[model samples]
Target: MHPAALAGATLGRLAHHAVSGLVGAALLRGASKAAPKAKPATRKAVVGGLAGGIVAARWLGSAAEEARLKAGDMLAEARSSLGEEAPPPSAVDIGGHDHDHEH
Candidate 1:
């Protein structure tokens, strides 16, 4: 996979995690106010959920980085097997840019 594509995927995952965390927090906060007797449990749930979100995001980011490194290693091996005379891989625009024509 291309470096740009890997970067795009990582950024997309980070964005997803951020949005989910915010939504989770908001939901928990709202739920907390609905029941006065379970206030302690609500607080615990909110804290746990926020912490879990952080851990999950970090894990996902690390996984993506690992996958990117593995892909690069595989690509390098393939290129070496093909020898230096082989043509380069085609350009891929993972950033959503239009590259049909030269600038």
Candidate 2:
């Protein structure tokens, strides 16, 4: 791989790791503070719920993505039926913001 690509990959991995670690640490700290004397069963149940939630999120994300893709297809077909084509990339307004702002 090119040095630039390697550096980019390394930076991406480091950023991901740093963010995940910070989030996980914050979650644990909050939970500990909220339940300093949690029962073993309660802890086990919380962990199980978190694990199931993570698994469910993956499937949910896939379903949401599939739905969005189908919606896009339908939209494209509808526009084509109406003898319309999408605006060019440069003509599309994103966030309704003008690009010619002066500092």
Candidate 3:
């Protein structure tokens, strides 16, 4: 439940929604060409696609969030079971570089 993780998740969800909406709009625009009356059908299809995309994106985001939370919980349980503490961010090493010394 770190704030950074929460913000990242939020941004990821929004990205998913935006991408899906664009895809839906594109698909609907193509599909509308088959209709007998082009204008009205195109308009309706665009609207419907946008709405459906939003709903689909919401569902996808929710599922992803659930999985993320579950994974985090599992990791926490494993750490607790092993009686190990995670290092603080500043104390952790990255890419084989030691962070123990001041820059």
Candidate 4:
């Protein structure tokens, strides 16, 4: 897709992985107290956490992608609406400023 989509996807995946790793590690450690071995419940918690994190991240990424696309479209529309002549930037003279201009 577009660069926005790619960037969103990449960032989302990274964030998802980081969060999932932290959560998973915490869960595993917490569960270790009850059962040192990897049990069904522990597995469930890890898998569930990972799945949830990924899904949420993907949704956020999609939303960001949509927003980017909308912003781009709006900018294009604004440019077209402005026609050939675009607005000029607002600036100050700054010629008589207090700064030392001698050199």
Candidate 5:
């Protein structure tokens, strides 16, 4: 990937993480204020939710990465089958247009 695009993707992920954290903190604060006596339970719930989210994210992320690799492999296989000098997905045009129409 181009450096700029890679940087943008990295920054995007960082932004998402930062926002998620801020939102989580706000939720915990609200929960604590909403139920003064149930602070312990609220804390427990928040912790559980955060843990569950982390687990789910990891599972889903791995699954997605695997899928992407499989897809790339399939693409390369198909191109070779077609006697192609076809470029990899990343090497395709960045103009948001389908290059498959020619193939």
Candidate 6:
């Protein structure tokens, strides 16, 4: 086999073994716990993970919307000043209207 291919295969196997070992250790630890059978969904880790995910999603969505609005405004401004000529595709105006579209 090629040297690079051999290295990649070895790395892949090592990663797989490492991940499997970690998962097995975690599962064994959980099985060994003597705690009473509590509801799985009520775990603190699960709730915290869910809340963090929701917050991240909202933040990303708001940021994307803000960026889009800013782009639109830049396009409108460019169109107003450039006038009649077709603005470059990358151009943004002060308002978000398409330069080619009739008002």
Top lDDT prediction, candidate number:
5
Candidate that scores best on TM-score: 6
For model 2, the run of ten residues with the poorest summed lDDT: 86-95
- The residue pairs found clashing in candidate 3 are none
Candidate 1 local lDDT, 55-94, one digit each (tens): 9999999999999878877887888887843334455445
Model 4: CA > 4 A from native: 1-33, 36-38, 85-103
TM-score of 3: 0.46
Higher-lDDT candidate of 3 and 6: 3
For candidate 4, the C-alpha RMSD (Å) to the true structure equals 20.5
Alpha-carbon lDDT of model 1: 0.85
Which ranges of candidate 6 are over 4 A from the true structure? 2-19, 30-42, 85-103
Off by over 4 Å in 1: 1-34, 85-103
Ranking by TM-score: 6, 5, 1, 4, 3, 2
Query: In model 5, which range of ten residues has the least summed lDDT?
Result: 94-103
Model 4's lDDT to the true fold? Answer: 0.83
lDDT of model 1 at residue 58? 100
Can you write out model 4's per-residue Cα lDDT over 6-102, one digit (the tens) per residue? 9999999999999999999999788777785657777899999999999999999999999987876777678878784333333425576678678
Q: What residue pairs clash in candidate 5, if any at all?
A: none
lDDT of 6 by residue, 15-50 (tens): 999999999999878865733465464477689999
Global CA lDDT of candidate 3, please?
Answer: 0.85
Q: How big is the positional error of residue 17 in model 1, measured in Å on the Cα after superposition?
A: 29
**TM-score quality measure for candidate 2:** 0.45
